[model samples]
Target: MTLTLEERVRLFGSPIPEGFTVRVVESGTVINDEIVSDTKVVANGYDLYMTDKVFETMRDKCLSKTSKVWGEAKS
Candidate 1:
């Protein structure tokens, strides 16, 4: 199903209750050394996964300054 940007944002950005955090994982990555994987956010007793396309787009657009800083810090 094709969702509008507003809908997508609403669906993905809704806040979880206190004492919970979102877990984001990329597709095709292993968790605990297992091949089969699912990417989702678990928070406040809820589990959610953004669509693959959305996840990829967001990941690609995210700033890497933190990673660059970490690399520089390590050097």
Candidate 2:
């Protein structure tokens, strides 16, 4: 089952930043060429197989857009 952003935050008590998704996987599920037993975070070009706390912290830094960029995004 796929966990929505809101559901993830509420149910798992983890922050799922924008543009990312959480997926619940079955046992022996192949993810990123590795066998996964539980959940995975689907990123832009890859999947992150991690626990709730690690995923929460990583997503917060990587996808939250909280860091400053050197230049403005060009349209």
Best candidate per lDDT, number?
A: 2
* lDDT of each residue in 4-52, candidate 1, tens digit only: 4444434553233334444555555444444323444322245334445
Which candidate achieves the best TM-score against the true structure? Answer: 2
Lowest summed lDDT over 10 consecutive residues: which window, candidate 2? 66-75
Residue 69 error for model 2, in Å?
29
Candidate 1 structure, TM-score to reference: 0.25
Q: Score candidate 2 by TM-score against the native.
A: 0.32
Error of 1 at 9 (Å): 18
Query: Which runs of model 2 end up more than 4 angstroms from their true locations?
Result: 1-14, 38-75
Instruction: Identify the runs in model 1 with alpha carbons over 4 angstroms from their true place.
Output: 1-44, 63-75
* Model 2 CA RMSD to the hidden true structure, in angstroms: 11.5
Against the true structure, what is each candidate's TM-score? Answer: 0.25, 0.32
